[model samples]
Target: MHEWALAEGVIKTIKEYSKDKKIEKVVVKIGELQQIDIDIFKFALDELKKENSMNKLSIILEIEPAVLKCRVCGKTWSFSENLKELDDFIAESIHFVPEVFHAFIKCPNCGSPDIDILKGRGVWIEKIKFKGE
Candidate 1:
């Protein structure tokens, strides 16, 4: 749902910013933390572009992984679990505010819960090709 919002926002932003410009290509950078559906987004992008006079538009998706650092040991690594495993962990932790499960979490290395999210949290419209009449 959040991914859909971001995707929709991207298209809206593109439309508003480009005005009369027609889009030919769209490149999106999705971070691992965002948990976005690339295929669904591709479908949404196609649907969005079809609503306009842009005729045919193509979209490309790029992936970026999130990195977490242990505040105690200074150990940093990419988030290694798939969505299902992450979901299970989240569900078992709090089940209410599962998002906060990462807060003040101790490092598995040094038993320090001071973990910092280092990367991969947002979506970016990396590049776009516009055909202007």
Candidate 2:
């Protein structure tokens, strides 16, 4: 059901962008921190696309790695490196609200709580391929 809500939001954005234009394809980037099930998300997209009259629209999904930067030490690290340290509940917290990462994670280099998300936080439309070029 959560995936359905996300899919609905995506469809709404596509609808706005495709106003009076034919969309050949949409490339979506999914962030790892979101913890989205790709297959479920795709299924939701397909169902929503048909409901929104976008049956012809092609959707391409790309998964991006989560990267975090330490604001204090200027060191960058991959989120996956620390994933094993987190329990299921903590991971779920980050999945629902990425901003809460600061509450549970600290900089690996300097042990500072001040960190910046470099990439892979949420899903977004990366590129839209339109018909007829």
Candidate 3:
């Protein structure tokens, strides 16, 4: 799964930032639009940690919900609030290309296609706790 690659990148980044220090905890914020499978991501991270002899490291994942602003009505709402409006085909399309949601999904407030995603577009490391030396 691609989660393995993502996990690897995270591990690499942590290693670089830690610079030989042991990691006690890692907090990751995953955007809702990214559609990351938590189970697979955790599995990949666990495997990577084991490989790197960091099995004791704690990984925490936080979900950042997608927020969209309607350009027409100037209203903002969570994407999940309008999930029922998305058809299977459109949902699948958005799952692959999150940017497409603005074009295909209309604003719930004014039914306008002009919408701007305010948040939840990318993955990031929120915080890292290093082990005491």
Q: Looking at model 2, which ten-residue stretch has the lowest summed lDDT?
A: 1-10
TM of each candidate vs. truth? 0.70, 0.95, 0.81
Better of 1 and 2 by TM-score: 2
Selected candidate, larger TM-score, 2 vs 3: 2
TM-score ranking, best first: 2, 3, 1
Give the total clashing residue pairs for model 1: 4
Candidate 3: Cα lDDT at 4: 80
Stronger candidate by TM-score (1 vs 3) = 3
Q: What is the lDDT of residue 50 in candidate 3?
A: 92
- Model 1 bad stretches (over 4 Å): 81-85, 89-101, 104-106, 131-133
In candidate 1, which residue pairs clash?
105-113, 106-112, 106-113, 107-112
**In model 2, how large is the Cα lDDT of residue 120?**
95
